[model samples]
Target: MPADAARTDEEWTSLGRSVLLRQLALGARSRHQLDRKLAEREVPPSVASALLDRFVEVQLIDDAEFARMWVRTRIAAKSLSRSSLRRELAEKGIAVELVEDALEQVSDEDEIEQARDVVRRKLRMSADLADRTVREKEMRRLVGVLARKGYNPGSAYSIVKEVIAGAAADAAEGAEPEG
Candidate 1:
């Protein structure tokens, strides 16, 4: 007979708790993620539900907090736009409302600034921006980079234009003959 064949509900609950605690120790997880982990371990449905409920009751599991921290960290580290962050949270099974609450922490100015910074970094690594053809190609490539990072097309185009123009002006100022 299988080892679990003779286990009682209490035994299954204990196993579930052990698995949950271990997973939590690694990092915060959404309720959905924990549920999937329990399911993968083949813990009985009722026992898994009970254990998860208890964890929630004691605040060991909080999707809201997880979403908030995730948003803050991803934005700071990746310079991701709100759309990209939304897609990431949704993939993690966070509820729409919780995702919105977390996204509220990122203001419009914050998004624009992050986008500008991304464009500036890309512009710095490219070929000369003084050549008309090179500047146009760089503009398209930079805008595409921001687009992939989840900026709106119009906004991405505008930011790329603004950053490239600033870089070109800086380069021109440096090239001017000394008095």
Candidate 2:
């Protein structure tokens, strides 16, 4: 065993706290997630607990703020649905109430538009495919992508259809001979 592994529990605890502090400085993390990570790194339960408590006391690990930021980032980057976001927050160890509050800040219209934008961006990359095939494939692909991104099936389907139709129209127009 390494010399460090033979150290007393208190020494290990201090080392764990230092490592966890560095991790938190890099990005936000949920208490549960951090605990799990610390455990995986072989940090003792007592040490991890103390470190987590210190973090919470210092406001470095606020579940409420974490939930809000998580929702905002996911919605803005991936256009995920409230259901998906809720599930994700739960997995990250956030309370149900906090997740609900965070979700309240995201509107249905905003999610729909974000979903549309994702589909549009993906469609642009497949411009070489034939029109009808492209529309069909993109519709299915978009719906799946949005669903995985945490969008509801109904909303994902609706937005995918709209985006596919618009792309189809554009493709047809572009193919026509200029007058």
Candidate 3:
């Protein structure tokens, strides 16, 4: 039979299983994400749904697990705020309730530390510039960066100021004249 011939039911199931395995191998994905990807690959909805059910049954595919892992990875790697994480998870088709549960795992201290780290990194990047200009530019950049990363403006500003002040104090001490 030519390649274009419609696949037998068995062949369709086998193909879908292969595709689902490949997708899972890439990383954890929510059911919606998987469905979209499988559909994009031209898998019939029925076959895709069946394969997804099998994966779920075998514990190979899980939205709750995917949400937890996604939250952890994004927060650690990107220092994303809960808001940013929530938005990203939503965009990935995760349910809001699941996203909230995952976000709840991120403590306030962790978020503040992440925000501080973001400010420190930006401050370091702009270190060679003039102090006033550097502070102003860095404050603006850090605010925007944190905001984009899902932090509130007030928290972002406070963290940026704190980091910049610390950096300036350190620089001043290092520049002091020795006896």
Candidate 4:
């Protein structure tokens, strides 16, 4: 028989604990993520449950805290909209209530500003803003960027329009000759 098949429940539990600790050492993980890892390692269901339960009892596994931190970090790093972040958290097995609670941290105004900031950065890097055709293309691309980042269509279009208009006005002013 293989070594795994010969292992007792205690040995399996020990393996499960070590797995959890190693994973935790790397970063915070949702309970479901940990459960999947244990299952992947072929740890027995009972042993895995007991170990996971113990970890929860000791406060080592708090999905709420995990969800909050994940939301904060993702927003700061990627400026993702709540819808996109919600989808991501769901994929990680975060509970609906926790996901909603975490999403609450980002207000509508905050999301708008983030989108604006992203559009501004992209606009600055665009070299052909002086040409109408290139400006239109850049506007389309900026709207697409916001769409891919999960911003609603209406908001994305409006933000891009506002930013591009402001940039155009500034450029026109800069091009005028001194009186």
Off by over 4 Å in 4: 124-130
> Compared with the true structure, what per-residue lDDT tens digits does model 4 show for residues 1-179?
88899999989988999999999999999999999999999999899999999999999999999999999999999999999999999999999999999999999999999999999988854456778888889889999999999999999999999999888888788889999
Q: What lDDT score goes with residue 51 in model 4?
A: 94
What digit string (tens of lDDT, one per residue) describes model 3 on residues 37-137?
A: 88876777888898899888999988888899998898778899988888888998888888898888889997898789877776664374346876688
Q: Residues 67-166, candidate 2, lDDT per residue (tens digit)?
A: 9999999877666778889999999999899999999997877777777888888775545445667656767777888878877788788888887777
Better of 3 and 4 by lDDT: 4
Q: Which consecutive 10 residues in model 2 have the weakest lDDT in total?
A: 123-132
Q: Which stretches of candidate 3 lie over 4 Å from their true place?
A: 1-5, 125-131, 175-179
The clash tally of candidate 2 reads 2
lDDT, ranked from best to worst: 4, 1, 3, 2
Q: Which segments of model 1 are wrong by more than 4 Å?
A: none
Candidate 1 per-residue lDDT, tens place, 73-158, comes to 99888888999999999988899999999999999998999999998877754478888999999999888899888999999999
lDDT of each: 0.91, 0.83, 0.83, 0.92
Q: How far does residue 139 in candidate 4 sit from its true spot (Å)? A: 0.8
Top-TM-score structure, candidate number: 4
Which has the greatest lDDT?
A: 4
State residue 157's C-alpha deviation in candidate 2, in Å: 2.1
